[model samples]
Target: MNLSAAPAIEVQNLRRSYGDHVVLDDVSLTVPQASVYALLGPNGAGKTTLVSTLATLLHPDSGSARVAGHDVVREADAVRGAIGVTGQLSAVDDLLTGTENLRLMADLLHLPKAEGRRRASELLDRFGLADSADRTAATYSGGMTRKLDLAMTLVGGPSVIFLDEPSTGLDPRSRRELWDIVREIVADGTTILLTTQYLEEADQLADTVGVLDGGRIVAEGTPAELKRRVPGGHVRVGVADAVELDAATRVFPDAVRDDATLSARIPSADDLVSVRDVLGRLEDAGITSASVTVETPDLDEVFLSLTQPAAPSRTASTAKELS
Candidate 1:
């Protein structure tokens, strides 16, 4: 959040092209340390390209990016040393046991043998894989496999992590479970740059959100700030009959009246004070509404409004495409 401090991830006018097609065009962003920054785009709005570029998996055609204070292109080794990446698919070996997977990561990190064993044990317990530590990943549930994959990523104690659609095919329960794990990771001061298609996931986790579309970042802000930009919040009041409906409309002159449902859709921010204020006015006017429902502009609405006409679509293959 502090502008003066070096960002965990920073990019300026980043451009990437494949053959004759542009995959990323003048993309720029900054992710603060110890915060979760979500890059939201439909299926293929160049989210993967952006992440891969930041992770030093791909070099930009122009501009510059830094990860953990190291230039992604110039100091790629340092950037790699400070970051971890979990792509859409589980990277764990199906034949390897849970403990073996973590051990493999530890070995790749070049940790001492004794330290590798200790780290693997800790990760198995931390990710709730202790009971299944000896079980082959082939027999693990979808959620378990994901946890192990993420645990493997953390074996090196990275300062920044990149997650590309971490919850792609997960069930709702599994997704929520992964969300909790993500929260815990951030709480530990590991900055994360996550690319996800789930609007709710970004809404729930991001300290800042960048909406990417057609290889460009169209919007950027906190979840609440983005929602406020699109005017959609309202309160709907249902009344008994024409008389009550008429009374409601008179009280709320700008309300959109519904004759069939005997309801009035009143323009409101859908906050507590606003809801109470509306109800108080209706009460003062001696108008009784049979039911009241509050609705607000969510990420879905903002996403649709911003990435439209040219909705998120797959572009040509980048240096590393998520298959």
Candidate 2:
């Protein structure tokens, strides 16, 4: 709902190829300022390739990427200055302390020594690394290293950030911690372009999620919208007695019944009318279910439905083979 038309990132008709392999074809998405956009895909789906091109780390055969109002290709310096990138792997150096790693970034940005030290100290505290600021990165735990790596990326105070699987190797707690950090960043009005193989991560963090399958966005929308597109949502009703269960099943033959739970899982009608109609019949028949709850397909369910089946309309992979 916060998707403003004021675009923070504009990518149009992007195309890229690897040697003779086509990776992205006619891909386009506009990210609103201060929103989180997640790029999700399985292996070889071009999620990495797309983010790399957008980050200006790799060149696209054709198409333009505009980040924070600067061209990624023509104005690479401006683009870099406006954005921060935390790649799939931790970029922390074992020899450096947490504060030193952040200082390295400040030095690269050419901040005044006083400003650099000031920013470093602030980021260390902001990222919850104040206790370990003096410890060598080599001695940091996995979560600590990741926190330090992320802190280093924020040293320059870039307005937009690119996070590619920031939580990939982290434990659940660490991942949750990273998620909290991401939320805090976005809350402060920084737009994010996130690439992750973890569907749950996308579900949890993305305001707008795009599914890249074989190099194209096969599906794109809010998490709930995408899940709603996939079928198989249902409402399960628990019947009070065996006689009521039999009557309910007779009314709806497609319902899956379980005698043990005294419940029947019926296909959802997606409307209150159908529910009221069914209940009216049950009431007339003197039958009742103990309770009912609507269950909808989740992100994992929707991802499998869109990506597992090879759709013929995919232009990216086909163009790659023929390129």
Candidate 3:
């Protein structure tokens, strides 16, 4: 994750349209080297279109996209060489064993025969599929199938990986395990561009998040920064009695008080130092609160605020392609 180097992925003024229906509109963003960047959007928000264009699967009508320093169009082969893609659906062949699947990917990558075998073995072990390596992929569980699919993406040792909703249907435990795997990948200095349905997944794994809406990135920043952009942050102080509550309210004149809950909600940025300052000032005024809690807007709130207004009524068809 060297910030000194050039970015791994960059797009500028990208636009794509299908029969006069615009899917991507003036989209632009950059993904730093060896970091995880998550692109989030509701159905029809053009997330998949962006990923496709960047991966060199689709051509943009106008504008430019580059991956791993190679232009996706003029240098498609170089861009392809530097990247691996794991799409929303599992790419595993049902009849092949987990070991066979890895071997297949290695063969596709044109690795030497002996090297392919070694690489397959390493991936089987790395993805925890060693025990079931010889078993057909058809019988593998959802989590196992996902791991095998992701492992296949790594057969070429790509510097940049595109994961398009890689954990879409996994259970909670499986999802967390996938997140752990993502962390490991970025730690090895591999940049990843992930498109996911899970907001919590972005919050947990992304160093930077881009919120796409109406065929463009509506917002892009660190999770905390985006959350801070939305309003909802405050500190709630619960006092022991009405006397303490009244004293705290006077100090925080703008606070909203709730007599029934014996609490006062003071609008704040919710940073640690600010929260501590509020508590210290209350203590100096000889008012001790029963409890103090800080609440900030979460990704759900940010997502809602940013996309809800522009979101179209989604359908099964919209989920598959850009609007």
For each candidate in turn, the TM-score is: 0.79, 0.80, 0.85
Model 1, 1-323: lDDT tens per residue? 65448889989999998987787978889998999999998875789888888888888999999889989999999999999999673579999999899888888889999999999999888888899999999999988898899998899999999999998889999899899999999999999999998899999999999988767777888997677666586788888889988888998897899999889888763333266777788888887555777666888988887774443344423212311
27-81 in candidate 3: lDDT tens per residue? 8899989999999987767878888899899999999998998899999999989
Error of 3 at 315 (Å): 17
Model 1, residue 27: C-alpha shift (Å): 1.0
Global lDDT scores for all candidate models: 0.85, 0.82, 0.85
True-vs-predicted CA distance for residue 37, candidate 2, Å: 1.4
What's the true lDDT of residue 29 in model 3?
93
Ranking the candidates on lDDT from highest down gives: 3, 1, 2
lDDT of 2: 0.82
Question: What's the lDDT for residue 95 in model 1?
Answer: 98
**Which residue pairs come into collision in candidate 2?**
22-320
Report how far off residue 58 is in candidate 1 (Å).
Answer: 0.6
